[model samples]
Target: MEPIVDTVVIVAICVLGAALARRLGFIAPLVLLVAGLGLSFVPGLPEVHVEPELVLIGILPPLLYVAALQTNLVAFRRALRPILLLAVGLVMFTAFIVGFVVHALLPDVPLAACIAFGAVVAPPDAVSATAIARRIGLPRRVVVILEGESLLNDATALVMVRIAAGALGAAVSFWDIAGQVALKAGVGVLLGLAAAVAAAWLHKRITDPLLDDAVSLLTPFVVVIVAEELHSSSVVAVVVAGLYLGHRIPYLLSATSRLQMDAVWKLITFLLEGVVFLLVGLQLRDLVSHLEADVATTFRVTALVFLTLVAARFLWMYPATYLARLFPRIREREERPPPAVPAVIAWAGMRGVVTLAAALTLPRSANVPGDLFVFVAFAVIVLTLLIHGTTLPMLARGLGVREDTSAEDALAEASVQHAASRAARERLEAAADGAPESVVDRLRALTDSRSNNAWERLGSQAQETPSAAYGRLRREMITAERHVFKIARNEGRISEEVLNRAQRELDLEESQLNRSDD
Candidate 1:
């Protein structure tokens, strides 16, 4: 096999794929996957043989780190019960169901191979779900549940896959597997926490903004390598470290460091997502080449497996969510059970790269029936992407599970608060400059009333006595100033680079001012 993949090709694909994905919207990944498939058909595209070890080492760590950093821990905590059910219970249930179905359908295939198939396809890809979910107005709770599940489910699936793979080659006891799983998971978590704590301490010690940002960038790779070196799941470790670091990033890093780190990660994540999906598409050619079975038979088996997986999610989600509500301790303080959450849960089960990668990496021993597994995995991914991903927005619309307008409302309220805070700070400065006491008192009262109004709006509280009639006017003034700055850059009144820097500074100031009310 050609030496894995060239770095130049990888970089080119990601850069081009991202540009295209942005222009094409939801179909970007689909487009990239198709491109990869087409490229694979060419004579000199280089046979991109994927190693399972490479994926666990190269691809998983940074991806998991980015996912964890972006995840809203507060929102995730709110949906903890649902996440647990989906991530742990539901994934295991799906694996067992898929294993049974695969065994019955393909009796020639070993049970261990069947279980391996199930394990590969169990967890939904975080990148794919987040991309699609953002387009539709998924409620914050639903998004959190999906993200948290994706982040943690890989470890569960990997443990089972390892057990299945081992059993296929030799006799394996359940107790041994269980002990290994516990050891791997426990060690991974401990290592991740230790790494995060060390990084945090180092961050605190270093005050230079540039060095702090550079150190933060190094974290994901460190966490992943450390975990993998210790024979643990790097995916779990990266996530744990990411969550720990992200939660404390604001306190540990300077404002400039925080800004730089956020921008760098966003770019990295975008490229990783593009490359992975493109590779998924490219691997289809290799999978197809190994098949001796009839095309129709393969299609039939794929469809059956796809339907089973979809049906299993619906079966699991409704009862699990309902049961979760029965225990007060399990329910989040702000969480109210949504009547139509079942539909949301069912629709959110879109599989992507992890499944494809696992399938492509299957051992090609003659007894393993690796071709069938790869074909089935690819079939499920395509079907899920087209059937579930394409129709999710329509389903959400039908269920009346529209985007929570609350965040928008909160943002508007935040903008108003920001304007008021700016005004308050200006007045305070003037007071410090020896402004009249009476004028300062009047300005202070205006600030207080504006602040109170913003709080009421954010809390969704009923309107009390109206003290400030010009909150809207103040917001518009701030917005106009931003608009003018943009126009100045476009008209070449200021250099584009300078304009971007100023705009970011203004944006940060606005965010800070809004946060003051909280």
Candidate 2:
């Protein structure tokens, strides 16, 4: 199939699946996966062979970067111990366990090959983690740990895959592998910090919103490319850069730029995730065709490998949770979670596109078969997404791990806004001048109206306020302007550029008015 046509088809499927998922009350990625799988078997449809580079470099960075952007810095810091245990220690542990099980399943597969495959499948996929968290009511801490682990674990897995491959090919020593891991990790961190700090400095100097947005879009790609060129972990670079930038956003960005940047990145992240999950599903047909083992043998080995990976995560999480609490300071200072949190975390493991991408990179060696390795990795991702992804929400519910609620969100938001409103009023008073008393009063009214919205939402349902009526009228005016501009474009009275500029002004005005309600 032509590349453009194929890309269009995949995107359409993803959007459709995502829409269907929401209507059916399932996670979007799972639906997209199933859609891709079903579409793969269509008659005369060509199989998709996504270049591993496209996903790893092109898609992965921005996804991680945006995810890190939404991360709460304080929560992530508090959960650092468990996050590292899952992200780094558990990744390595799971890889070894997976390697052992795969080797046991297929005795002919070399230990190196087994480990290589394990590394590919080690990390629990971030997409499933985020998507399921939104659909289900995962606690804030659980969400933080899952997201934080995701942002770092891929780098760990990738570096380990590289080391395992080298050990098999060139007889590399254990200490050498350890040194390589440390050096790459350290360099990656330095590179990410430098990149993030430099970007923020430049951002401070740039006055144009368009230029600022362009830099923001390019941030993740540049961070990843530079780190990769320097023989560091691009994934780590993206994550670190994201965290730094997100942490500084309140201080660094103008209100307009923050709003624009938020919308742009959200759109970008959504599209990338959809494309990835859809592509994941589309590879099923190809994987089945290329397996070297008989159908029964392949089924047995893949199931065993997939099951072992899931079991390995559960086995590792509970002990690690307790291990962290063993420190007196940690136990004394922090809120101790119920044991059910670890169980839900364990059950939340669902491998996705990253594993598939890594599997595609496996080279056929003297002893190892690349096709078989790819097949196993592919099976593990699909099987887990099918089994674990489908069941995780229910499992978390059954275990009483639910804490996400509108009430909690509203309470937190109300508290932040309440404090911010006080600060805003003080700043306004400090800057007061010969400006009209009415202007100052209007500003104060807007601040109070905005801050009290969440509380009002949680309280009694009331009649429409005067402010809401004003906002509704303003939106109608903006809608009229949009329609007029669009008509002029259709009638050839205005150029496309002119129409877009007009529409954008109207859109921004509408947004400002709408935001006043909240």
Candidate 3:
């Protein structure tokens, strides 16, 4: 039951659960959540409490950073109006609506307290949406909205939570609080940009890839703390920094650093994402153990809020996507909003840790029943994540939603690599006078191989594309070579070093082939 020991145990369960989730073909987060719930019932098990601060500071940054990195900033800007409508406008609308419903249903609770609960829980969870969205490859615009909203809505929700908490006994309208909140949010954004610039400057000077990756990990936390200390939006700070860093990362990172970062961030994302959902399920016990309201009333209120949650999103998305297109300027600049895109975005409105964490921040003096408040937040999170998260892929497939083809992406990647490889070949040609003919031939062979691979991807038909045919042959040859290498190693015909060197070459070729296919 020691703190570290308990922490280790939970992480082990999450790691094991993540492995099982992948192998069993379930969404990893959903599985981790189920596993966490199952573990809660083990006899004499130590209590697991997820702190709001830890979720916000320790967890939110890197996840948000990674999501920002994955997002295309220019594309995000093109969708700016709709993204704002959902991220900011819808967040506000949901809070007011949920607050009124809660107040009307539970009049004994102060209006501000009910409203505060609404504010805390209004924003769809960025983490939850990101985990699922990335896996399924929601349409590009949908990804932008889901991800952009996730990054931005936290600041909106938290600002409202603070204002609502401060106005508990007052008759201040939520709209009236918006002005002050906007001012504070602006400060947070400016500060976040400053932090990002500072971090970028520092990153540029560090030559070591390991140290650079470490800096990349730390940048989010440092910015979050800076923003929070100034009473600004830490989420905004992290998001802004992440977007900037991710956008400019190519220019700043060495090739080796870029490769290292890709692998490191993937592992970090997989595990952190696993733990976040695992923590979601782990909190179920605490939320339900002290049910302080009438069971039926609690269920009714929870059901009402859940319905409002889904309805608010649909209502907002339709108008935001289609109705706003009535403006000539807007229509001229943006794609005619697709109908199916909104369906995916609406279904993606699952609230997450920020909501729960905000729920825990409720002030006791506000006279709200803490158990009822937490329970409602907990129930909504579970239902939405379980329902929305699990059904998203099915919904996408049912709706015939598909991401850009891997072939399309492969072509783009190949084109960029081709350009770089050509530049390298030009440089080598410059050094041809000093270099021996054997070195020249070997280098040219490697360049030609890469160039052919790129050119094959461009013109190939379906799976029978040239790269595909080339990869199949190459893989078969590599397989044969691998077997021979193993046999030689086994029969003592080759030394370990020689066999390993040869095998490494085959492995690299196979991996390159797999990358082209993917």
TM-score of every model versus the real structure: 0.78, 0.90, 0.90
Worst 10 residues of 2 by lDDT: 169-178
In candidate 2, which residue ranges exceed 4 Å CA deviation?
169-179, 462-506, 512-518
Each candidate's lDDT (Cα)?
0.76, 0.84, 0.83
Model 1 TM-score, all chains together: 0.78
Candidate 2 per-residue lDDT over residues 250-269, each given as its tens digit: 88888878887888888888
How would you encode candidate 1's per-residue C-alpha lDDT over 1-518 as one tens digit per residue? Answer: 23344766776886787687677774566667767777888886666655666666667778888788777777777677678778777877888788879888888777777777888898887777767777787876777887898898888778778777767866544455557666887888898899999999999889787788678778878887777678787777888898888788778888777777778878877777777777777776777777877887787778879988998888898888677667776554445567676787687787877776677665667777777788788878877876777788888888887677766777787787878788777869765667787877777776776677666565533643342224344456668878998899889899988888887877776665455434
* TM-score rank order: 2, 3, 1
Rank by lDDT (best first): 2, 3, 1
* Candidate closest to the true structure, highest TM-score: 2
Select the stronger candidate by lDDT from 1 and 2. 2
Question: Against the true structure, candidate 3 has what lDDT?
Answer: 0.83
lDDT of 3 by residue, 1-518 (tens): 58888778878888899789889988777788788787777779865777888888888888888888778999878777777787789888898889999999988888888788888878998877866877887776677777789889888888888888888788868567678668877887798789778878977898999998998888888888888888887777788878887889888889878878888999888778778888878887766777778899999999999999899889888888888789998888877856888888889988777788888888875368877888899888888989998899899888877686667876887888889888989989998997789999999888877877777766736568655777789888898988988999999999999998998778767877787676
In candidate 3, position 240 carries an lDDT of: 80
Q: Which segments of candidate 1 are over 4 A away from where they belong?
A: 1-10, 42-44, 169-180, 292-297, 328-339, 406-518
